[model samples]
Target chain A: MNDVLDVALRLVAVFVCFLVLPLVVGQTEHKVMAHMQGRLGPMYAGGFHGWAQLVADGVKFAQKEDVVPENADRRIFQLAPAVALLPYLLVLLAIPIGPSEGAVGQVVDAGVFFVLAVMGVGVLGSLMAGWASANKFSLLGGLRTAAQLLAYELPMLLAAASVAMAAGTVSLPGILNAFAWWWVPWQIVGALVFFTAGLAELQRPPFDMPVADSEIIFGAYTEYTGLRFALFLLAEYAGIVVLCGLTTVLFLGGWHGPFGGDGLGWVWTLLKTAVLAFVVIWLRVSYPRLREDQLQKLAWTTLVPLALAQIALTGIVKVAIQ
Target chain B: MREPTVVAADAADYFQTYSVVGVLAVVGVLFVAVAFSANRLLRPVVPTPEKLLTYECGVDPVGEGWAHTQVRYYVYAFLYVIFAVDSIFLFPWATVFAAPGYGATTLVEMFVFLGFLAVGLLYAYKKGVLAWT
Candidate 1:
């Protein structure tokens, strides 16, 4: 009874946080982007720079349309968004949200691998969404996403391995506990590789060519509209948050604030994820998406090699420290 | 700069701990329920022929939404997965290789693992998966 109740509570929290996140942390990115572009952001929607903009967007998407193509698979079309969104929800179950004092979060043994494996499975949604749309553009989008995800997943995992070796555990908390010092200095290479891989994983700008808005009208998501489409978008943003959360936990030390002490652990975790998320959005607004061929070259030639070297360095660090 | 509490807890035990906390589950269910319900009540609905048209690069459908895509796309994805998984497994093995007493056994296990990984690479190469043309 307690276990079920506990699971329910955790899931509910994830949903709530996910809902408000765009309004909170995401607002920072939007405001920053707006200031950069010389425009006022979101002031009309909820007053005070559109605080309720995301809510308004969600409400609008629901009643817009839920079209099913004449020849497309009905079941798959309906199922696609759900599939795409499910992994992100599941991914939340294993991440540590706050410090030990605040919440008993960060559930799971081998949190690092567990989070990545589940997150990687998000490709299924892309594949299904693209195929079920019965649109070539959507199919191309799905194809592109699957390839992009698979290409970068390796380097991301390998980069995490460098941290894993230093920390000597795959558990999120374990990785946090094992931090001899800040992971940024010695682990900068792995950190950079991981951040780049994360862009490809989230299909963010520069790497977001798969969903190129102008070229494909949102690509795999073109066929979707209304609430279902909104769900997919929410899931995408949620996945980014989860990715940043995982990245922070794995390398920055889960909930342990910088300059020592875990008292304000939750603050550090939130702020760290927010900053990373901002940087991600910043890059999106500033850079152009890579061509498909260029994207592949980045994964195979650049990121993979960098990840391998970082992993090698990790081995040396482990031996030297001991 | 700040670092998280980098302490080692039993991997399995940590999971047991998060389950005891009642945060994430709460947020997930409440928001999903609200998202769907709010749409049901608040949004207006009036469908039209124009709205129902299949999207074609933001224009009216050209010929059909469903068109044949290149088989090469699928092949590339498959090859990418094989390489990704190989490296994924290999990295963990490498990390564990340096753990004091486990070197010899880890090495043997790794070789066996590498053997499987090698076979897949060879198959893909033989099938010309890496070739763009």
Candidate 2:
């Protein structure tokens, strides 16, 4: 049937995006970070500026010994990477890539809540990896992750709730349809809070104390090796793509361009997401990692309050306009 | 007869949407499994005692792996629980807040709810539970 074919094609596209976007982001990070530090990165791997560096890296990882620590709970340690990697793939299914109904992989009515809930499941991956590793550093890293999640999760949720409030709908495409140019400045505070909290949730730089390589020896992933470690690395990059894409949808007017139509909408969406992804990498190059205390203080004292104010402002303006 | 059929169709549609996510999850797991199995075939696995030992900067790992972690983290977990429950109410309130006549009332009502949560956060702050030390 046509319906079945349509579903199959969409899944294939989502799966392909899930595979490709992360590698692109990863490669960007390698070159961008290298250039920022005054070096050329991976110029020889694929002949043309090392275009295939990540592919080569993947090949190399496949041949490395899959080292599982003897003291680890082998099953959970092995399972952790898949757990971390799958949520982003699932989240990608609900993201609207264009204005039309066909743009999304699967149109869930409550897409916002679905994405948030699914993304939250990724925290467990790190926790499992940390606890099952049976290493002191791994356990500390896992505990740090739990604490970090507790601090950042609320602000993220609150910031998201502000956007949902403004749009008066929880669907991703519905939010896009409701988006007006003015919502940019109006929702700017919530956007910043959401992006920051999301970065912390993904354990990205500055907020990456959970896996602070200098301090924790890569935290929950300390014992991971070979393809298993590579999977976790892939999950981190995939997470960057999802977060940037979601920020684009929720705040920056997904699929909306200066001259608007359903045509070329996907292009605008991808372009905005790529720009946001650049900002994420640029941020990594710019700031020193925040100390644990400072990270928590910023989330609680600054982001949470700012998110609350943004929500109040949104409510007042909505009522006033009515 | 017509009503039951329509309801069944609606239920099927709901499941159909989620089934895509289900398939994607399965595919994700399979992607990793395939890569891993490929590695298993290609990689040399000559494990030694030293290689399997818990890595601690090339030194012998000391003490038990399950070292006593600071109990301070428990407090954050507790706070997360309280706030998470509170935020769940905000979603429905958000929908109602933008409705034609419900705007002002929902705004006031939601603020009261947030005010309570803010008080809870303030109490924790006053008690130094927010302090990392």
In model 2, what lDDT does residue B120 have? 87
Candidate 1 lDDT tens digits, A45-104: 878778777778765787665566665677888767766776777676667756562253
- For candidate 1, the per-residue lDDT at A316 reads 58
Looking at model 1 chain A, which ten-residue stretch has the lowest summed lDDT? A101-110
Winning model by DockQ: 2
Tens-digit lDDT track for model 2 on B23-121? 888888888888878888999989999999998777999987888876677887888899898897888777768798787788788788878888888
What RMSD does model 2 have? 1.7
What C-alpha root-mean-square deviation, in Å, does candidate 1 show against the real structure?
5.8
For candidate 1, give the lDDT of residue A45: 81
Model 2 regions more than 4 Å off:
B1-9
- Cα TM-score per model: 0.84, 0.97
Regions of candidate 1 where Cα sits further than 4 Å from its true position: A1-9, A97-106, B1-50, B58-63, B91-95, B103-133
Error of 1 at A276 (Å): 0.6
| Top-TM-score candidate index | 2
